[model samples]
Target chain A: MTDSIGFGHHQHACTTNNCTTPLAENIREQVQNHPCYSEQAHHYFARMHVAVAPACNIQCHYCNRKYDCANESRPGVVSELLTPDQAVKKVLVVSSEIPQMSVVGIAGPSDPLANPEKTFATFKELAEKAPDLKLCLSTNGLNLPQYVDQIAQYNINHVTITINCVDPVIGAKIYPWIFWQNRRIKGIKAAEILIEQQQKGLEMLLERQILVKVNSVMIPGINDQHLAEVSKIVKAKGAFLHNIMPLLAKPEHGTFYGLTGQRSPTDSELSALQDSCEGEMKMMRHCRQCRADAVGMLGEDRNQDFTLEKIESATVDYQAAMQKRITVQAQITAQMTEKKEQQPHYVQFIPLTSIKRGLTKQKFVHRPILMAVATKGDNLVNEHFGHAKEFLIYEASHTGVRFLRHVKTDLYCHGDDSCGEGETALQRTIHALTGCEVILCARIGYGPWEALVAAGIQPNNDHPYEPIEEAVEKVYKEMIIAGKLDEPLQQQLGA
Target chain B: MSFTINELCTNCWACEPLCPNQAIYEAKPHFLIDSRRCNECEGDYPDPQCASICPIEGAILDSSGQMLNPPGSLTGIPPEKMSMNKI
Candidate 1:
């Protein structure tokens, strides 16, 4: 594993409610903004849960979850499943209209932790673009212990676990079976393993100082009497709050409890359980039982306003937007090259004035940095140093190549005629190339080439007329093979 | 959610731009995805932007350890039919 991976850097210990680790510090600052964790925040702030996870590992008696999570109590269905890019665009659109959107959750519509790759991808992108938005995930706590390290790495502030029961006897009555390892384990054995895993996972999360919320479904005559015990255990384990939601059973839902004609808890019966659990730990009374693609504030579902169709149409191509900036730069470069090419007599043009500053002194802190390619068009390194006015910069590393930006420069070499100052044109050109570690061009004159060497800028004019990306890739690979990619050449050469 | 780029990667530079997270990096043998940065485009694209554009087959694998763009997956031809055609 490399340090570049998201979850590889945390080395802190935070086991108490008063967390002080870097990971815990990030969580503490973010948790208050989340609507689900703070009831006051819910009224002022809104939360949106995107149903990106499509798989589940366990079975619940009251759940007939298909593609999304079973944690949602209401019979809300997901309209459309979106990829990470589409989801981010949808979040932007929804957040624009509903500015109170403070938390972005991935609470089933399936367990977010069950689909690790899909869940984390959405969080990683949001972490970069929407840093202010607190990230929250709801899971079944089946894989919580396994992903606690990753949760810390991504700085996930709030986690909700649908822990219905603490005792195995009561858990068995709630969950019929669980899929563990590679097979299905049913009956009491399944509930025993699940209870053990949930407790261990909850303890691990608390130890890491991640604010946790427990959701328990109150089934009449089933787990209703046992929920107060559930509240006590989770609160003792440092759970922030416990939400006991009333079960909404319907025969058409095809759940085991629903088909068996199980009774749905009345409003008073549900309130009674909440009232009892309130003594042991704080009880949440405001859960809306949101859908997979739910948007807007809690208790109000505005999914109809921003349908998948609307979101898809509103979704701008993020990659194209970043590249569009480069396209504009490229057009400017093409126009400059075209005007320069149109000049019939290149020799007639002379340097207007001598740049008196003796070598455009640049104080650069030597570091492993980016390089630029001088090209006329066609994304090829075909332009000469003296004739070219623009250079496209690229960030190259072991992982991939990224177009950073284009650097503009002044024309320097004028064929046989000297540009006034003794090697002033050469120095001026090299000065423009400052900060860039290397220059990839088709041709460079001896004076400018030597000047580039003096300035500690490695000039590569050997592979002329090659595709710009290929040339850059070759240089990057050569640097990697030579074990000289990590350190700047200026530092290595002591220039 | 990191994916690996095996020797099959052609370095066509197709996958580099579409990566929303910018995890893919340019390396010696081929372009590599920074494991830390790569989410296999889980929330971004149905098929990874890299594998979707890559001309080379079986170049990228998902988190489930399956080839994202396997042979005949794009062509919609059955594997048996493709093998018979190759012969």
Candidate 2:
């Protein structure tokens, strides 16, 4: 298993609470590095927003997620709605409150382009305002064709479309109707318009080099059995990422976004789908189901600043806004105040940046005595270097010589493919898992290099040419010169 | 709780290292316990260990009644145990 096909990297994705390893992991990794977000990025970093696109040219029963709109929304969840301008203002106000806000996206809240002017304006304003932020837009293909150029023009990185079925008969069950070229088409025709648009949109965006992440919401009673075909077709057409989101049956977010809100697929089912697509296409199992015009990482919400009533007050007036907002927010204020009377003052503020930074610790240290076995078998390992802290022995097809005469430390090495750096992946995983000081390897890749640095693994790749014995001798000599090798090896070598 | 571990476990020990909880152990028949430590990274990131790196099928079972772990993770049931039972 080479870096392209190995399952070592995605293991990190599968460990947390309710996560799924993408079915097609190899393809998933390839797709995730689409210039916007890498596979390594945590979903906690991305935020979601349901756009107020109220105008999807096509309709998928599963496409009913919304922003926190004061207007009617999902049943239990509280949502506040804002226009494009308001969305930006809210974003600027909230980002300072949350640090992991890196990417901004407009998902279904409604089809972004269905409300073309607003979506584009939001994108434009966000780009101009937050130049460092990446932009993502999800849509129904009915409007995708028209916006591909614009998507590319703005250098928007991620574009997800809900494509449930390629077969019109099956597609009809998931989608109710579509508005195409000014006409409302329903049944198979609507399905065809959407599928055609989906295929066309996917093709065009790919041709233009925009990253397309296709989301296929798996419904047990709907298109669950035949979803792999969707993966194959999209992969063939170059859709970079495929996310088969679990169908949430919440009473809110439309009928499908959480419709039945019945139990979604099991981890096994999700893993099966991911496995099916493993070799063929990249799969996105780490979706946050973000809100439209969401600013930040996937599955994260940053608008903790304003509430439904307070939002309108936050509208252009920061000073007068509070006074205006307070009048409108007064009623909810009483409800909150009443609750506060019954509850303690409790708040949960996440220090995400600090934790993420803590996860990545990097420092550089120098060691003169280095040891590596050159012969076959347990060769690449042994006690040799003067400043040996630990000894690692990796199982190699060709073992190295047993250098018994040398300085000692601890023993280490792994024959397991994922245990040691596999020429491309080990440096990173080791750095993340073991906290290695400096990984000495034959070759390295960007993924491993970054992973190591992120884990604070100082890697020294280019080692001087010397036999294992010679290298150990050099270590002792260097240590003696530095006045630290007062050990037995140094004494035996008569340094 | 939509998952399970199938009979495809080979005991190569590839997955034991990947699991966050050290959930897989080298017991009698090459053991693996849920301990529910595998929450699918929901409150955390996403996905459980058995589904991520297991090379063998049926090793890590998901809610769909399928083996999520792939082929290589199914290192085998072990020769010592198999031979001892026969003897």
Candidate 3:
């Protein structure tokens, strides 16, 4: 938060040895403590990306990094094209394949800040599902100033800002035009606004103690002469690190490269710029500028299909499989609802949506409902669940509850089997999510019985031949009579 | 509301072994949850062994608003539990 600029000493794997190793000190500190970060970290994978700024608004002649939505097998990267669920699944799979994966980064995959919805959603899912994984976002300077507060709330640690040139006069030649406040602005005005926003974003992030890294693309002809100055501006702005990358040119890239057709940065040229950034702003020599969800080495593309692969892998593959599950679930719902409805008058399922609604009804009672046990209903989830469904015998441990029909998890149950399985999963889910501990079941085993006792769950698997709904009501009676539940979990029946 | 594992376990023995539970075991397609034997692990450990060991976050989350562990901090030890936020 101090005004001083910063560049983290932490870097990801720097050698071709493996992209999974932790680089630098900051990440190392976390890595040291993380269960997954030790030498075993080598098993992990790295998914990286370039910023996804659909509209650069400015022109950078040396690079052809921008891409719009197209098919899976395309040249440009996919930006303006992803959903939250898609990103979450990608993080799950990618990190799973290469166990060493410690982070989910959104570097250009579109100026991460510009595509706030896309970026935040992806990170949010990763945080919830894979809290152990770290998150990083890199962006062009355009909208970086806007999302500063959000960065802190999400605990985003590393941010890379692309500052191609600090000199506005030089910047004008590179940027053809820009959209400022809904109006088009030519060269100088665009450059000024951009510089201001970039600086503001950097200052804001530093003040909040988030790591900020500045990236300056070294164009041989255009901003090549402006490297030191650009470095100076960003370093003064409090960038934790500076990455000076050589501009790569491919003639087919587009108008920018076709016209400028400048040569790429030689090895020595890049080294010198890195040296300049080293003294004032710690230089970032390990930048891979990877594609979104890019796996393997930072710079190399090991992905079978980069763009769409990440998205498609997350989609519900068998539409009919989901439909079938939904159909079965509808039946289970009626049965469960009917059972809950039969519970003693004290326990109600009023159909109220939120606590506000229940409070408006002015009725607050501890509806002591029996606890639940979630079974790994999904075929894949079987491994995580050591025991089969046991209402009476439950090993008190957590299990995935796949209430969302679309999501098929590492462990989840589906079908008529899921009715019993899902009910079990749901009961455990209810207790875990709510913290009330009592359950209704047909049977449970001894090992799980003792374990549940240790954790404080009271399992009731004694009922036989009773309507499942009636059995639930009976269980409610036992809890209330035993003083296990004060009233009941309420659902408003009518307005 | 509490959590329990069901049948359908692979007995891959992952969860049971991971369980601070000693609580989990090798069963059918999934694991089982003994209500009499489960407590969301509120006081003993930093995280719910069931959830953490489950290898799934949602697998071991709070049941509705009755959260043993919310999205905030595990240790009420945050300087703010005193409700003061001062050094």
Which lDDT values do the candidates have, in the order given? Answer: 0.65, 0.49, 0.47
Off by over 4 Å in 2: A1-8, A11-37, A48-52, A63-78, A250-263, A293-300, A308-495, B1-87
Clashes of 2: 94
lDDT of 1 by residue, A1-495 (tens): 111111111111223443311223444345434556644344345779877765555667676543222223263346566677777777767776665677788876566776788789999888877665678888888878899989988888788889998778888778765656544466689888888888888999889878889998989888888888889899888887788887866544545566566898865577567656665665666566667788876645677788767877785444444344335434534553453356322212122112112323232221335777887644468889877766766555433444444444543233424333554655666665666778999998887778788898888987688756557766765665454544544665786
Off by over 4 Å in 3: A1-45, A50-59, A63-81, A305-495, B1-87
Docking class of 3: incorrect
DockQ of candidate 1, scored on C-alphas against the true complex (2 decimals):
0.01
Top-TM-score structure, candidate number: 1
Candidate 3 lands at a TM-score of: 0.45
Docking class of 1: incorrect
Q: In order, what is each prediction's RMSD in angstroms? A: 29.4, 24.1, 29.5
lDDT tens digits, residue span A1-495, model 2 = 112221123322233333332435544443322223343333123344534444344545554322244322221123544577777776555444343445566764556776677778878877776655567777777778888888887778678777888988888777766655433456787787788888999999888767777888777767788888888899889876677766655333434334334456754476567656655565654343444444443322344545544554543533343344334334433443353344221111122223224323222112223232222111122222222232332111111111111111211223445333464234323432342234443344666567657766544434433222223333333433444423343344554
lDDT of 3 by residue, B20-84 (tens): 43555444555565555566665666556545423121233344534332322211122223222
lDDT of 1 at A187: 69
